[model samples]
Target: MKVGVVTFPGSLDDVDAARAARLAGHDAVSLWHGDHDLKGVDAVVLPGGFSYGDYLRCGAISRFAPVMSEVLTAAQGGMPVLGICNGFQILCESHLLPGALIRNDHRKFGCLDQRVRVENTSTPWTSSYAQGQELTIVLKNGEGAYVADEVTLDRLEGEGRVVVRYVGNPNGSLRDIAGVTNERGNVVGLMPHPEHAVEDLTGPGTDGIGFFTSLLESAATA
Candidate 1:
């Protein structure tokens, strides 16, 4: 499988994402934010970093990048997309996934190994995980709190759209949500850095490999 990792100006983790993809047994393609083409990648990943210096909002400027047009269309067409941290903010900004990532309630930048429960394993990015499985991954961001209206929150909960929930409230997110997926389960967004955990020497463990491996497994099954 070929997975494209997009790099916008100021993107810090594109290289890490590509490395993770390679380690997961997929060809990793470096995609530029200014390009409209996806280069025939089977899946896409929006890695973390402060795009456009997070000027207008965490992901506000990145939502208008040229590459996002293709990403938006492909994601809607059932191509798997995983957005991590700042990437998750971009996904929300692009409306590919619902809800918003606001500033942490404590008004501080947070960085740590966080415990998250895999609530929904049906998504392409999560198939390698068992339901209710808890794993630790790196979480770092300034605006990581996820928020949505009561009705939307209710719908997400009722439909099992909630993908990951924080073991402990670290960012004051609504209902302790750490990640979510679209109705089709093709697109997923999370604030934790799964790519950082793909190697044991570099992270808590290799548990993060599941995110990339899950996509390949899902594709093979399909």
Candidate 2:
């Protein structure tokens, strides 16, 4: 499988995401934010970064990138897309996913090893894990709190679209949400950095590999 990792200005983790994909036994493709083409990748990953220096808002500027337009169309058509950290903010800005990421209730930048529970495994991005699996993924962001209207939040929970929840509520995200999946389960937006934990030599453990492997497994099954 070939996974495309999009790189926007100031993006910090695009290479890490690509490395994780290659480590998972697949080809990693580099995609530029200015380019409209995806290079025919099977899946796409919007890695973490402060696009446009978080000018207007986190990922607010990146939401209008040329590559993002292609990503939006592909994601709507069922292509799997994973957004991590700042990328998650972009996904919300693009309206491919719901809700918004806001400043931490403490009004501070947070960085730590956060534990998150996998709530929905039906998505291709998470199909390799069992339900309720907990992972200690890296979490670092200034504005990572996820917020949505009560009705929308209730709907997400009701439809089982809340793909991951914080085990310890580190960022004060509403209802402890750490990640979420789209209605079709093809697009996912996560604040924690799973790519940082994909290798035992560098990260917490190899638990993060499943996020990448799951994509390959899901495609094979389909």
In order, the Cα lDDT scores of the candidates are 0.96, 0.94
Poorly placed runs, candidate 2 (over 4 Å): none
lDDT per residue as tens, model 2, 1-222:
989999999999999999999988889999999998999999999999899899989999999999999999999999999999999999999999999999999899998888999999999989999999999899999999999999999999999999999998987899999999899999999999999999888988877889999998898899
lDDT of 2: 0.94
Which segments of model 1 are wrong by more than 4 Å? none
Cα deviation at 105, candidate 2, in Å, is: 0.9
Error of 2 at 21 (Å): 0.3
**Residue-by-residue lDDT tens digits, candidate 1, 132-212:** 999999999889999999999999999999999999989999999999999999999999999999998999998789999
